[model samples]
Target chain A: MESILRTENLCKYFGGLKAVQDVSINVSKGIIQGIIGPNGAGKTTLFNVLTGTYNSTKGKVYFKDRNITNFKPEKVTKLGISRTFQNIKLFKNMSVLDNVKIGFHTQTKTKMLDAIFHTKTYKNDDRICEERGQELIERVGLSDLKEEFASNLAYGNQRKLEIARALAVNPDILLVDEPTAGMNHIETRNVVELLEKLNSEGLTVIIIEHDMSVIMNLCHSILVLNHGQKISEGSPEQVRRDENVIEAYLGREE
Target chain B: MMDQVFSLIQKLRAKSVYFLVLIGIFVLIFPQLTDNQYILHISIRILIYMLLASSLNMIVGYTGQYNIGQAGFYAIGAYTAAIIATRAGYSFLLILPLCGIMAASMSAFLGFPTLRLRGIFFAFTTLGFSEVVRLTILNWRTLTRGTFGIPGIPLPEIVNFQISTNNHFYYLGLFLLVVMLFISHRLINSRIGRAWVAIREDENAAKAMGVETFKYKMINLMYGTFWAGIAGGFFAYFAGYISADSFILDESFAILAMVLVGGKGTLVGPIVGAIILTILPELVREIARYRLVIFGIAILVMVHYRPQGIAGAKAEGRRIDVEKEYEAGISENAVETTAPGN
Candidate 1:
């Protein structure tokens, strides 16, 4: 499979702390790749570096063979890589539809003059945002609550809205950090099914999840992280059987 | 009863255009009905403040940037108009946009280094910037004429029609306000507005959604300060004098109070705020000495009760009420069906 995203020995350090040290990851096109790790194992740090939220101390990130190292988050997003937060970051005061409409920021080009004059570009872009925003909301099954403020949504629904907002970016790769965090069993299953459906539709997904069941059931391949270093990388069966992965999860026998 | 009230609100919202037209007509003919120069003068002040507050709203309310130094931009506009009109002898038409552009450039200069600062740090920088502008105006005697102020500013003329009367200034102020409102309304309803609100809500999320947060913030600051400059230029011509004292830190706080008391995010909120805050003091002349104290109380009450302001978009509360009503309806149906079986 063709690799869509490749990182070369990416290192991100915070002074004395080596949060992510010389970690390399390769994500193939059109497959669900999972990164699983214990708390404070720098899974989020890796995602932050990938999405340009943090500058890697050393190493390069290549998106489709293009170097995107230390690019601003907006620039990274415009290059068709969108992400969600581990802690959901929906525009709480905005309506659900408006929240999703904002996701199309890069795709729209209505400047001050165009907006003030109500030019053809403004009308066209506004219509596109409204129509496509509605479609994305419907896809996330939040059609009934489109007009509702995002803050008013249930936890699971908020997560869905975040995914819907991320999807509005029309990204080639979607980096979802802890999509199923704090979800009930049913909600977790729903998210798993949603990811599966999206993967089948040809989106390259890189998910950071803690639930072993979700990783085992959904990911085509899993990368295990312990102490900011890759402990195992393979199919779920192979990772589950790996000695390092076993010791990392269930500690070594006394 | 609740349903009736909701329907009534919906009907009012649907007919809001007609109501706006009626208000517009009233405003258009207000000077004709009133020969009172005091009322006209006060009305012009209200209009100018409306412009200032609304512009500041774009920064504080929409983009979620706290800019307490709006008076700095206003002073820049006024001084730009005062200096250029007196020395260079430029037309009001030319001077107006120059004033806006000058202030916008200053805001861009200030915003470049400080837009990265979050919360109170950014706010303090703006406060400091406003003071810096005022002090420069005061201390730069060579250019600004020190505490003596630039006086005898010629009345603005449009094709030989002199804007000397209070009524004339009121109309000019009204025209400027209308233009600002029209442009603001258009911008707010479009993609630019959505990006601003997104940044205000969550800067990181806005970035993740591909909004260049810094660029947008700078744009927002410039657009807002641009109007402050215009208002200041208008003030220079209307007041027929320019002084450092006019654009004090207190003036900045007053404009901020108007936005907060009236409502920040909504366009109409600042207008309402400007009207009440400007007119209320004149109406209560006996308590005019305690104006600041009263403003403090009003802001306190507003913050305690309605932090979103009077005309704020109450999406969260309104939606929750609707959901409650829907759940109640379902429970009612359940009770009705069980009663028939019993």
Candidate 2:
């Protein structure tokens, strides 16, 4: 598969501590890749750096063969990269419909007067956004909750809503952080299935997961990290049998 | 039967076309409804406050920034107009936009450093800034006439026709109201408006979405303040006098209350709130001292019982299904978690 994202020698520092050190990874187009490690192993920090949540202290990131190191988060999003927060960050007070509507905001070109006057172009665009939002809500299986306040939704549904919101941005690359962080085994399996389905549709997915079962089942390949460094990277079976990987997971309480 | 009614409801709920027509008809026929000078005077004041509240909504509601310095910009507009009309003898038509520009410039200056502050701190800083501007007006006796205030401000004139009557002033204010309302509508629908909403909802997420939060916020502040300035200019000429007292913290709170009581971030809510609040005092002139208490009680009840005001449609009796809302939910119960071979 052709590579869509490449990171070289990426590092992040919190004061004097090196949170993510000398990390390099490549994500190919149209694949479900997984990153798994124990707590404080820099899984999230690496996600942050790649998506421009935190500027890398050193090194470069390239997407579609263009350097995007130290770019703003929104700029990264505009460059076809989108992400979900590990802890869901949704517009809680807004309706679920409005939440998704915000995702299309970056792509919308209708003028303010158009919205106010309900001009033909504005009306058409507004209809399109609402219809598209409704379609996405249905795609995520939340069509029944279209007009409900986002904060009022059940926890599991909120996670699904986040994905729908991200999809509204029309992203080519989706970085979902902890899709099943608080889910039961069944939910985790369901999430893994969904990620697989998305990958089959020709979208690149880079998932950060803690569940070993999920990582092992969903990922075509897995990259293991320990102490901000890569300990192993291969097909799940190959990494599972690696001595370093076994020692890394067994030696640490995490 | 339900389908026809639903279609009608949907048409009304759509929020754009018909609402414009309704407001347009109301504005045009407003003169025929009442010829009372007191009513005219209050109508003009309502228009001014509506502009203030609408712009304030952009910041406090849309951008999620707490700002109490609207009066500072209001004063800036008043002072700018007072200076020009008195010293330069400029016409009201010409002075209107100039005052707006001056207020916008001053707002940008105030908003630049303070945009970093959030919540109550931001609110307090703006309050402090307003007091400082008030003090400056009080001390700068040479230009402002200090505490005594500037008097004999000229009314807006067309050719040799000065708008001397309250009816004429009402028309002028209505004209300004329409213009400012148009601008507000335009600004809110633009990319700048979306950025403001994103910032209002989640600043970090908005930044992640590639919106320049600070810049949009500054624009929000400037636009709101600029309109406030124009309103102040109108007040200066309409009242035929002005002083530091006219642009006090009470004035700030009153306009803020108007927006909040009406529903912040909504276009017509502020206008409705401003009109009701402005006209209430006059209606209760018999026991003038009790008017504020009555207004306070009404606001309190409105806030507690109907927090969304007229503009907040969802706050009413509608129940929206949470399941079909956003596709953000999943069930952990259905997936069977099995080990590698189980």
Candidate 3:
């Protein structure tokens, strides 16, 4: 598998606490890579560093053969890397469609003068966002609630909406942190199906999950972390049999 | 009953063009309807406040940046117009945009460093900036004449048409207000407006979605303060005098109150607020001495009951409560799941 995103010895620290310690990850193109760990195992910290929300204390990140370390979050997004949050951060006041339309910010180019004068660029941008945003909302099965305020959506629907919003960026790779967190089994199954469908469409995904069944069923390759270090990395069968992963992450079987 | 009233408002909003035309005709024929100079003067005051309140809304209401020093930009615009018109003998046409530009540049200077500061810290910076502008105007004797102020400011002329009478100033102020509102409407409905709202909603999420939060915030600040300058320039010519006393901390608070009282996010909210607040005191001169108290009470009522102001979107207060509940629920779940691990 050809690697599209490679992090070389990434290290992010908060004073004396090593949140993500000397971790290197290589994610291949067109595959769903899973990162599984116990709570406070730096799973989210790694996502934060990869998405440029936190500047890595040391090491380098390369995306599609280009060095993109220490870039701003907006810049990373502009370069076609988009992500969702562990705690959903929807614009609660805005409509579902408006939230999706905002995801197209990097792609649109309507200047201040253009907007004031209602110029051709403004018309084109507005039309594109309206049509494409509606399409994306439909894709996520939120068409019926397109006009509804985001905060009004059910917990499962809000999770789907976040994925729809992330997909609005037309990203080359999607980094989703806990997409199924706090969801019931049915909601979790639906989310897993959605991720699988997206992956089938050739969209690479990097997922952080605590659900053992989700990681086992969805991931092409799984990496298990313990205490800010990668303890095991291989196929699900190999990881399930690994002594360190069993002791540190998945408790020993009865 | 409240739902019926809201539905009626919504219906009225649907035909807003007709209402605007009716209101326009009335305002145009208003000076003709009455020969009373005081009525025209009061009308002019409403128009000026409408401009100030709406411009400040762009920052405070729409973009979610707390600015309590709008009077600072107003002072900059007023001084720019006074200095240029009095000394350089520039026409009103030239001075108007220059006033906007001058205020906009000053806003950039202030916003660049302070916009990074969040919440009350950013608010205090604006308050501090307002005082600094007033003090500078008061102490700069050579340029401003200090306590004496710059008097005898010539009446503004547009291609030899002198704006002398209260009625004339009323028309000029109306024209400026319309221009400001038109531009604001255009910006608010477009991508720039969306970016501003995105920044206001969640800065981190907006950045994740590829909206440049800082750049958009700067744009919003400059766009808003530019109109504050225009209002100031209009004031200098309308009063035919310039003084430090006009732009004070109290003046900034007054403008903020107007935005809050009317409704922050909606276009018509500030206009309604400007009309009601500006006219209420004058209509009841007996209680005019307690004007600040009335403003305080009104704001408190709005914050507790409406939260979105008079013309704001319905159920905004309820939405906030829902968000808070959702957050609390999430935190509780987090605690339960992590309790045994720690």
Q: Highest TM-score: which candidate?
A: 3
Docking verdict class for candidate 1? acceptable
Candidate 2, position B145, lDDT: 89
lDDT of 1 at B91: 90
DockQ of each: 0.34, 0.25, 0.54
Can you tell me the DockQ of model 1? 0.34
- Candidate ranking (TM-score, best to worst): 3, 1, 2
State residue B79's C-alpha deviation in candidate 1, in Å: 0.9
List candidate 2 stretches off by more than 4 Å.
A16-18, A110-135, A182-194, A247-254, B1-36, B159-161, B186-191, B276-311, B314-342
lDDT-best of 2 and 3: 3
Which run of 10 residues does model 2 chain B get worst, by summed lDDT?
B333-342
Q: Comparing candidate 1 with candidate 3, which one achieves the higher DockQ?
A: 3
Candidate of highest lDDT: 1
**Candidate 1 TM-score, true structure as reference:** 0.92
lDDT tens string, model 3, A1-254? Answer: 88889999998876766778888889999999999888777888888899899999999999998999989999999999999988888887888999999998999999999999999999999999999999999888899999998978998888889999999999999999899988899888888998999999999999999888998999988888766778888888899898998888546677
- Clash pairs, model 3 backbone: none
lDDT order, best first, reads 1, 3, 2
| lDDT tens per residue, model 2, B122-177 | 99989998899999999999999898999888777878898998778778888888
